[model samples]
Target chain A: MELHDKIRILADAAKYDVSCSSSGSNRENKNGGIGNASFYGICHSWSDDGRCISLLKILFTNVCIYDCSYCVNRCSNDIERALFTPDELADLTINFYRRNYIEGLFLSSAVYKSPDYTMELLIRTVKKLREDYNFNGYIHLKAIPGADINLIRLAGLYADRMSVNIELPSEKSLKLLAPQKTKESIIKPMSFIHSKLLEKSESKKLMRHTDKFVPAGQTTQLIIGATPESDRTILKLSENLYKYYDLKRVYYSAYIPVFNGNNLLGVSSPPLLREHRLYQADWLLRYYNFKADELLTEEELNFDVLLDPKINWAMKNLNLFPVEVNTADYNMLLRVPGIGLRTAKRIVKARKAANLNYDSLKKLGVVLKRAKYFITCNGKYYGGCEIETNKIKNKLLPKSNVLEGQLSIFDSIYKTESNLPILV
Target chain B: MVNYIFDGTFDGLMTVIYVSYYNRQIPNDILSENSYQKNFLGDDIYISTDINKSDKVQNAITTKISKEALKNIYYVYLSELESSYMLIYKYVRLGFKIGRKINYFLQNDIVNDVIKLSQRINHEAYKMIELIRFKEIKKGLFYAKIHPDYNVLPLIVPHFAERFQDQYFVIHDVKRNLSAVYDKKSWIITDIPPEITLITKEEEDFENLWKIYYKSISIEERKNLRLQRQHMPKKYWDMLTEKQ
Candidate 1:
């Protein structure tokens, strides 16, 4: 295939990986680098999926040797095959960067004849971008499982971040849906990168002076609703990964059934709402300082469809309500229903100025519709007279019909935020 | 009545506001950049460019409104809205009467109008962090020239400083002949030299990668330029890396 043709195929193949953050790296341009990466910042664009296109995510090649039943670019699937030489991909990356089209490259690939060859192409493309093209911008490369350990390590040096898709939650699901892949092949490289990050972290002064390994760290995606694992199981796996692997992100992709596997659990799309709820829960885990047990039990396959993860937690723990925002510790403030990180920080800042009043609390953009049930204003309860959990559920239900009527067949979808109804 | 005219800067606005607050009978009109002779058929007029007097006026208003409040009024003036020039005068006058409770003006429509203009400038400044992709030029100087919808040159420095810590760079807002320069240690608001031409950007190494990434990530099945244009209008494209 021509270079452009290869770019087309590989890029389309790699679109399914959605980890796009390029912030929190201290990489800089030097004698011959083409771009630099920054901390606390990342460039973003919108995909057709409305997903933020922060990185120029693509693949080095889409021609695979292994047949993963869930993937569209699997070897068994009859699709156009292509591959790009490292130099060609590098040149394209530089061109795009110059035009301000993207922050950096997100290079991934199918097996492409062999696992080692695919890893080599991915590594070479990043090296050409770093050494030959002098590009210093962010580059996120996918570590191909079953590739040589040395190759994965080299790839890490050239890329700012890396990800290996866990794809499914359990070994049984993997065996049933993708017989060619194994649990060890995926986890082994991830464990290696995690330890390497730790080693680099230990020699922090030297790594600080020199360019570090994957300053944006690593991420991985899990396909939701593809296996029978409950939300509890998924959250437990995520908790372990965070505790052990120190993964930067764990993306949940809803299964969109383009093809059927004999062992696939669902035929229709995994509820996108379920995916959204998972993100909310993930946010609670990462930012709101909540545990998986606080939000869900082993029996529940999903969170309450009507409420957000934080609000649901607040509903479950009504005893924690009417907590004084003025005296609440940072973690407790973080758990308040209407308060987000920004609001929490703002409260901390505003409280130092003077004792915040109920009026002032509302002015800080606190969503009283839900927060009233969780907080007291000037030591006075405003959640409601009874404040029953079931009553609060009906009262606290946000206006869901926001974009539902807004997305009529003839209406413009982009003009609205959502297609669901808000039943307050 | 004497005119307290000063150079076109925040100091100049401050001087005028300070002088106007001390008295209520001074009828004045402003002439800036281009002055044309009009038929002064029925009215008597006084022309003044007393920069020192303007400075005196600014000092007094700073005392009356507090330095922070006065500084905010000056930022509103920089927004360059025609009403902004008058709004600053009225709000400052109101501030002098209201004392330290000048924040009440934030609710008044006239004050809110100027706030909107200031918000536009601030928004442009924020977008600069996201949209202003830099290209390294000769001598390790990183530069990016932007043509933004609002004059946001003054507000982008702090964000870039926190983000790109060790780098030295210049963000030029071509529309207003203004730029922000950060030299690793500190940032300064300055202007581009008149002798130098604005550098024309070409398809550099990173641009190729970015364009390919853009084309590759855009699924042909779900290409929606209308939605894209709605979120990011074409006018904002010149400064945008991908659109450019």
Candidate 2:
């Protein structure tokens, strides 16, 4: 097949794996290297779906041996299959980087022939890019499940980041949809990468400036709404992954329906809002020191689509609010509905110099509309009239369809002072 | 009311600040040369670009306040806002009076304005870094043209230089008629002709692939053009290969 045809087929197949970030790694270009990774990722363009096109996210091939029901390129699907030669893929990446079309390559593949075979092809392409082409850019290689540990280790040295998709939330869901992929196959690589990363850090302590091993760390993706997994279950699983595997990110891809009548997966497509709320809750967990149980419970299986996860938590725990803005510590300030990581830090720094008022807080980047109800300035409350939960909820929730304006799907990127979203 | 005129350069603005500080007089307005308007009743003072005076003022700011404060001042100056000259003058005056603690006085209109102006400039520079797409022209030279709201050429050049160390590239600020050229080893800022066209025969194939990838990646069920425009604004569509 022609190169353009191959790119279209492979890239289209890989688009479902929505991990389009090229950040969090600080890989500099060597003397004769062609590119470098930006600590804060750069967005080359926005897709029509309003998603960032950061890395040149494409699969090495779309031919699969495993028949995962939720996937587009499953074995049963009679889709056109195409693969890129190692040299061809490397040359394309260099040309694309030279034209400033992408940050780097995000190469994944279906289980074509076998897991080890697919992984070997991926390792060959990346090695060619890194060693032969002298490309020092950010590469996020998806580690093939059930692939050899040695193969993964060698691939990790060249790639900045690696991921293994925990496609479904639960073991039951995995068995029901993807029989070929066991929970063990997915978790084993994650555990191995975690240990290797720990070993790398320990060696670095012994000898300063040690060798690299997945310097950006490992990330995983869970297909939300494909199975009957609650938000609580997903968050709990994600928390454990963060604690145990030291994963950089747990990407939640809103399950988009490829096959209309697939009885295995009931839902046509997961509401993008649900995926968005999970991302918000994910951010709160990572940055705001919030636990998964605090965000949701088995009773409250899903997040409120109308309100953000943080604001919902704030509404439930109103007693914590009316915290003194001037006296509140950084963590407490962060709990406020509108106060993000950057704004909270700014308030802390700005308050050291002078006593802060509502206006000063606004100047420091706090969203007064939401924060005012939760905070007090100099023993004065600007939140106004009878601090009732219903009133506050009404104020916080939009009077009209708030999602129309607010539901940008990628609001986490634009709204949070942090440029890179939680997915990165 | 007295109006002070400057040469529209950062050094000239600093010289104006120096003159105002030494003379102990607050001008009603400080205007860049192109922005200065003659008024029959108001007194006018045209400050020349004195490098020594500007250097002294720069040193004073660096020594007394902080390097961060100086950076903020420079960012605010690059904004070229309608009231930037006077606003920066007031901010500098306040800084000199309060020493290093002027940033804490967010209640002061001048201090708040300066901070906000610098934030705006920084936001623009960040956008420029993300949205500036280089097109490969003839002889493997990558050329990117940007018309940023703020003068962010100096701010974004360092990022490109470090990233594209092995490749020849030019990031041209078309609105300002200035170009930053990087030739693998080093880079220099120089003036360029307004209508320079450089395109390779094979560039179209790469652009087509990018556009194809962009279109294929978007999930049609969740199409939101409004949100896309918020980050990758419509003003930058012409320069983007995928958009083309």
In model 1, what is the error at residue A212, expressed in angstroms? 1.7
Q: How do the residues A1-424 of candidate 1 rate in per-residue lDDT, one tens digit apiece?
A: 5555666677777776767777667787666334677665454555444445666677777778888888888777888887778887777766555534567888888888788988988887888777776677898889998999999989889888888989998889889777888999999999999999988888885655654688888889888888788877888788888879998778887676765444466555445666666766776787677889888976565677677777777777887776887778778888887777767776776676467777767656566666777787668887765666888877765556211221222112111211122222
Local accuracy of candidate 2 as per-residue lDDT tens digits, B135-220 = 87766678899999889899989888888887888988889888999888888888865334657668888888777787887877
CAPRI-style docking class of model 1 based on DockQ: incorrect
Which candidate has the top score in DockQ?
2
CA lDDT of A6 in candidate 1?
68
Instruction: List, residue by residue over A73-105, the lDDT tens digit for candidate 2.
Output: 887888789988988888888888887778899
Question: Candidate 1: what's its TM-score on chain B?
Answer: 0.75
